[model samples]
Target chain A: MTEPGRQGTPLIQLRGVERVYGQGDARVVALGGIDLDVWPGEFVALMGPSGSGKSTTMNILGCLDTPTRGSYRLGDLEVTELDGDGRALLRRYTLGFVFQGFHLLPRVTAQENVELPLVYQGVPTHERRLRARESLAQVGLSGREHHVPSELSGGQQQRVAIARAIVSQPKVLLADEPTGNLDSARSHEIMALLTRFNRERHLTIVMVTHEPDIAAYARRVVHFRDGHIERIEESS
Target chain B: MLGNALREAIRSLGRNALRSFLTVLGIVIGVGAVIAMVTLGRGATQAVSDQISSLGSNIVFLRPARGFGPGQSIIPFKVEDAQALAREVPGVVWSTPVSLRTLTVVAGNQSWSTTVVGAGEGYLEARRWEIVRGRGFLPSELRAGVAVCIIGQTVARELFGADDPIGQRMRVDKFSCEIIGLLDAKGQSAMGNDQDDIALIPLRTFQRRISGSTDVDSIQLSLADGVDNERVLQDIRLVLRERRHLSANMEDNFRLVDSKEIERTLTSTTRMLTTLLGAVAGISLLVGGIGIMNIMLVSVTERTREIGIRLAIGARAADVMLQFLVEAVVLSFLGGTIGIILALTFSFVAAQKLAFPFSPDYGIVVIAALFSGAIGIVFGFFPARRAARLDPIEALRHE
Candidate 1:
């Protein structure tokens, strides 16, 4: 945890990003305008009240949703107006997402789940297996690689999900409530796992959470109120 | 990438084992029914045509017009009429003058009532019969009007069980005729008559002793191969008309029956029947394809969240669609393979039991398999598109 923002280039830059749903009367603005920048090798938490657009911000940051009126440059590439395939390519190479619900494929084992992203990226089987095993080990799920999600505890399932997220060696990890479904003890364990990966690999992590304790793991926490960033707090 | 798609599809399909099997079941029965029906139909047609062709494909039957239908009596045809047909008919190569009489033949302690057909040495050639044992009546014997006969298999078995009948003499009413030959067994005629329940004798002897008349009952003509049978029929008609002195535009006093025409008629009728059966079976295949489509749609809806997760993890929409399509194709292809094996076995056994040729046409099988696979692609396309077009955020939000 000694170094923060040490990598040369700013990884994610967003300016005047807005996402509006529907048209005319049905138009409910999900993200009014979001201006944010995340430097390389930084871990940031997005915290907000319900319906304050924390999820919307995560979706945009994860490249799952496109902004209505702004520029989003993800590592020197404009992503705001990019098509679905272009965003997919960016996600494949640069971004990883861990959902709040721990969306591990139900019938498949942890190792197979971890190998999914690499499979989509057309990685060879041997390399995919090696990298999946390595990622699972990094997430403290070494011996549970063959256990399916149904056979695992909530925390273990979430660990498998994290392994899947980072298996492709993505530069940016976007996690939405990684500990949302876990208890206090299990939540803390997951937070420690994420912290070790962030600190050791210098992996830039953008996580969304309402719990202040969960936000405490990040070096900086950005608070959101009504689709806009209210304030940013830093920890020593 | 294809391998990955296939692997993914396999996993998803394996998740719901019963549903996967049930979904493929429709295809299985459809392909199976089509194959079995076509195969069995062809077998039946082949058996029928074989039976009809056994009546002598190139032979024509010349009977007095009054001899054909019930209540029609005849003065009968003359031996000279058959001789004229043999000598002067354009396409005729041989002729057999037939005269039949129903009489009780006695041998040792056994007596049986059977129809005895009187014809020349050319009868075997005209009827395409073979002397499996002994020998047919010689020309000299036919000319001499010798009391000799060639017995049918049924007659031979009835009179001489477990014993040779070649040199045996059977009583033909007041005349005793030696069994000079035995005709091979022909199970049944196209008209369902047991062909082995009669006996054959030289025509000259039959007319002098049995019939007490010189009038031949019917004339059977064997025409040369490659000659137009209809033209030969017309030539015989003209000759018979002249001999019978029938007026122009009047119905002739004779009937010229072409065995090949009967065969063609029966074949067309059976071909039509098989085609109709094939069409009905094809409908089941179409219904099976519809079933696949319905199941695929349901599968896509059920797996919406999985699709969402894959999309979020950077899976292309095309990739997801391909996975589902490949899954459907695999299911249908596998169903087709199973159906083909089952149909072949079913047809083979059924053909044997029904006494017909068991010709399993692999062309139909190959086409059926490909058709089933193509059905998968066509039917799977819509559902795959639905899954691919799902909004990732909305899908993930779905419970």
Candidate 2:
């Protein structure tokens, strides 16, 4: 494992990224002229009102969508205009995601959910299980190995989703409203767990949320409005 | 990735157990219907072929051609024509002239109107008639025009009961004929004729005593091995026309009919029925395939959020498509296996009760299964594409 603070290279670079939807008279801009850089071992938060393009930025950052115009680099690969399959390949190898609802597959056990990313990576079964178990243990879910999402509480389910996101040891971890569905205490617990994973494992974390308290947990906060970035704040 | 997709599909099916079972039910009934129809058709074809084969192989029948209808003119078959058939045709094994008429026979007190056919020695072999008791007409008995006849089991039962029928005398019209042989039971024909309720006698005796004429109604011909019926029929016709002194342009006063022609017609009819049944079954299989597609599409819709999550976590579009396609295939294949089992059960019961040869061809089963899988792929594609092409944010937003 690499050291947490030594994020030696520029892991992601974006310049003038724009995403437009529809066509002709119906054309609307979802993301416009955004420039940003995200490095490894960094916890960043993107905050905005609904329809302010925070989700669009998160999507572009996650490689789930491409910008209509711009140059974007994920690690060493230029990925802004990658085809569907190439983008999928990038997601498989270099990214892991946690969604707002915990997004834990309801029927699978907690351990199986943790093992999902490694499945896409084509890791052998025994190795995947071992890594998934270690991730679950790291997230304080060792005894809940066989528990399904429905069997666990909101916090435990979010921890399982976090475990899934980190299991592949992906280059970047993107969390979209990871604690949006949890209570305040559970939200804090999820944030603490995510921060620990970022600090201890040196995982790059990009979280999207509307809560200022959630954004405060990150080292940097980026605010967006009306499809454009408004301001960026750095805190010790 | 493939494993995850499979595990997810299985889990989804388990979660919605009732819907899944109902979807599978459609496939089950469709496949079952196809197999049942096909099996019945196959059995019918086999039964018909067996019935035809039960009749004598390489046997031909010739009927006298009257002026316009039966009993109009007495231009019936003659012994001369029968002799000419035996001597002239290259592959002719034997020929026998026969005359048949219905008459009431009285033995002790029992009386029954049974078919009494007059034939020579060759008729027994030519018609596949078996002797269960006594002996067939001997050459001396035939030449002497002795009033000896063979009785079928049905006739014997109606007249003799448990008593020995051989050497018993029965009154036919006014003359008495001694029973010389009893033919084995032959059951019923497709035309519903009672084949076993008949009596056989020497043609000479019938011509001289019973019918009061030397004219035969029909001539039965048996050919040697490897003789083609078409060529031999042509030879028989040509020889008979020349012997009868009929002009080439004139219509023949005799009809030479090959039993093989009847065999061909029956076989073609059976084939037609088989085709019709198979086509109907094929429609069911197609319906089963469409059911699979419909279910798969619903599955795609229900799993959109899951698909979006997978996409976010690094699944390729092709992966999404393959997952759903495999699910559809699994459902169809399972249905096919169950259908084959059901078909076998139906066939076994039908064979046991109806005595038809019920056999299911594994080749057809395999073809049906393959067809089902192909349908799954074609139909599962659209929904799978929808899942793959989903906007992750929009999908996550879906309620």
Candidate 3:
């Protein structure tokens, strides 16, 4: 894997980003002014208790939500300046996400679930099928391609979701508490798979979790509290 | 992308097959009722025109008009009035004074209740009726009021059965008459009355032997081909008014019934009824559209998380909207197809039962199909907009 310090330019940069909700009396601050940078090929973890703005930060990074104030840049594009559709296009071409709930469409088979992102990209059918199968195999789900979400175990379903996120070869994978519902053994297996992708493909990763044991799998860990980044530490 | 959206729509609808069917049931019933009503209404209108045209297009009936009130009296016409109209009116090709009475006629122990008509010479020609057997009345027989009669097909069947009615004797109220001719069958009139259940005798004979009065009920006239009907009618009115001695300011004690006028009135009335039925059925179609809207709203709400998933995975809002819209369209289109089939079957059977023509209006069928699809687009829009506008962050958080 490439060393984070060896990279001259960060792949992702956030400068004084702030997110606010509602207005007037109903106003709430979900994220205070914060600054951060992530180089290419880095596995980063965000850790905080509930309401610490970690989830909010992950949402903003995934382009699912926009910063209310300040600049966010993914590569050369200014994300905070983009419109809803523009941000959606950015997500479609550059970002992937694995959620805590493993949000696979309930009745769709694993192969179809993995093919969704490619479908959104207007990929042709035969090639889409081939890529989806390859992604599923990469996640160690070769024979479970036709099984629906309800028929699969939680770990297998999350793997399918991971396969879906990475199927289009996105530049960055944003995983929010991906193993939150899995057992300790399944969580380790999932963490190892994420780590292998990060090293083997040099894919940038940004993950959020509350557990230190899970945070330990990343090369760097950032702690958050009360809508602000408290500190960040690196590990060899 | 369109193909994918369509596949997605079909798959989602299949997930709730029972709900989808129930949702489209309203549309099915609405379209079916509209098509059946229009188809059957057209058939009834066609039947009316056909029946009226069968009565001969150039015929007109002149009858004494009763005054407005309930107990008002009517002045009967004389046979001389028919003769005067026939001579003085330019377009009057044939005219006959007709008097009618319902009587029970007995022949060889077989008796039947039927109408007995008293008419002057050339009555059959005025009515465009043919003598299917035997002969018409002789001039001497008609002028001398002889006891000879002609029987219609229905009268022949009821009084004589398979035997020849010509040369047979049937008893009128106070006299016996020999059958000299047989009239062809005319089937039923527009009013559903049996037209062929009648016996015809000379007017003088009827006046002398049956009623002992010289009163005529009505005058039947046939206009010559290509004549101006209104001019001829005005001429007849003038002649009748002078003969009956009506002053210039007095209303003539007569009324004219033209075949064309009757046909127009009847057709317009049936068309109005058809429009009324179509409007009522259109209201039901609107209700069906509302049902679709209601179900689509529910479906969007139920699939909030799915929308979120799609959006989070980088699907455009338009994509999500298209999927739901296509689902609604497919649903209503399916209902339209089934409704058309049901309507065709129902109208076919009903036409057979009602004894009218079975003519399906293909234009209306095509219109109903397209209209049902339009309903989907119109009603499905609001819910689709709601789905497309959802915030992915909140939607993903929804359980």
Candidate 4:
């Protein structure tokens, strides 16, 4: 598992993690005994087809779901043992998320949408505004802060979603099909933006996508099939 | 967190202003009706008690009971009966016999119909009535059955126009009588009767010239302070029964009504009416609450993706719950405020139209306000819980 550029402990670690839904007779395994590690500053993409458990793994990584069994650790904290509220607190302070749908509140301005994470983090209004503006500027949406999601184009809206994700300065950013709704050019722009954030801020990111071209942006790619990791590959 | 939630709630409600307003209309009507009913009811009770008090405290009305059976006949009391009761009953300070007849009186070709009350000495004192202008009847005038009368404000205004009524000659059915005094205006009785539309004459003059009989219609008795009214009433019943020669098996033909009893009855009746009206109005408030619940549930379902985004973005279940709860509460509270203002305006106008005092019951107002808030919490809880408990992934997947 050791590579030349990798050093120190993994920021996220999963050991024999499994997620099962329903009970006997109706039981289904979404993730079956998965094991993975993501080091700090790493940009890893998870690739798989439909029902291949890639989304489930991303959900677990984002602290939006819990493993039915086995230990999942984010930094030093054991995430699998945490309750809903405790997981929520971890997400609030240590993680951010970007969805496939660019789920900005339809009526809220871009500025307010970007401030949502910090609002949950209990940041004061003035600091929240400043941080939100800075985050929006980082995503190349500098003057579009007052526009509602419906008023913005799809690319602009996705940028606002990106700004919202990173406004809290979380330790990790989880993107589930982040550019699935965009055209090819827009998709490349969004990937380039993610790459820049990863390189400049040393922000760790875990992304799930089916497109090989999108996966090409990640330094390492993990392929999944039938609720288990099929193989891991290095791009260079 | 609360401030953000409140701002969010207000913005969300503002997005659908017409729907929000329509949803709260039930609450508005409910609270408005309750407040107006309670206010008018309180005013009515106040007017009744005021009229009763003006009739003097510790007073009683004694009258011959009407015959109930076909062959039975009512035997009216004579003037001597009132004097006898005053002499025989302990705690009785004074008593006066009264006879009433609705008659037309004429002065300077101005003729108007009015009630003529034939009362003996001490009648005005027993009734707590005062002479606003001119003097009361002289002792000799009452004894000699002289043709003299005291006109009430309505009669004075009707018969003499703007001119002074005292010393004016007014013609009754058959004789001319000089106006001895003018009685102060008492606007209306609890029963809504015109109290100032009457003229007062000596009992003997009414008996000799008008009715041609010696029968007294009713007697007004004023009692001494701190006297046991029940004991005095029982003594009066005994005296009347003995004087009328009623057998032990026969029922007394006289009925006595205490002013305090009438006051209690009227006050309680009005209070009961207030409660009934308030309850009927409360049903509408309940309907309003249901409306809030229905709309909130729809909101939760319609905003499923929004809730998912909020949850996925690290908002706690409690935070989401509070957001929706605050929305519902704000809607109902706004309705409650509007209802209070509308009720006050309505009650003021209604009070003027009905000729009763306008009294707003603040205690009830506050209670209704808090109750509306409680309704929000109670009805909003289910929908809020549903929103809070939504699965983030599934909700995001929802359209």
Per-candidate Cα RMSD to the true structure, in Å, reads 2.7, 2.8, 2.5, 2.3
Q: Which stretches of candidate 2 lie over 4 Å from their true place?
A: A1-8, B1-18, B24-34, B66-74, B160-163, B190-192
Residue-by-residue lDDT tens digits, candidate 4, A85-157:
9988888889989988999999889999999989988899999999999999999999998998999988899
After superposition, candidate 4 runs with Cα above 4 Å error: A1-5, A22-27, B66-73, B246-250
A1-236 in candidate 3: lDDT tens per residue? 45556358799999999999999999899899899899988999999999999999999999999899988999999998888888888778899999999999998999999999999999999999999999999999999999999999999999999999999899999999999999999999999999999999998999999989999999999999999999998888
User: What are the clashing pairs of model 4?
Assistant: none
TM-score of chain A of 4: 0.97
CAPRI-wise, candidate 3 is medium
For model 3, residues B1-399, the per-residue Cα lDDT tens digits are 889887887888888899988988889989999999999999999999988877776889999997444665788999999999999999999999999999989998999999999989779998888999999999999899999999999989998899999998999887999999999988888889999999999999999988789999999998998999999999999999898877787776789998888988999999999999888988888998999999999999998999999999998888888888888888888788888899999999999998889999999999999999989889999999999999998898888
Second chain alone, TM-score for each candidate: 0.91, 0.89, 0.93, 0.96
Chain A alone, TM-score for each of the models? Answer: 0.96, 0.95, 0.98, 0.97
Which residue pairs in candidate 3 collide?
none
Cα displacement (Å) at residue A215, model 3 = 2.3
lDDT digits (tens) for residues A12-118 of candidate 1: 89899898889999988888888888998899999999888888888988888888889888888888768998888888888998888999888789999999999
On lDDT, the leading prediction is 3
- Candidate 1 regions with alpha-carbon error over 4 angstroms: A6-9, B66-75, B101-106, B109-113, B171-176, B208-212
| Preferred candidate (DockQ higher): 2 or 3 | 3
lDDT of 2 by residue, B142-236 (tens): 88889898999999999989999999999887789999899988776544577899988888888887899888888888888687767888999
Docking class of 4: medium
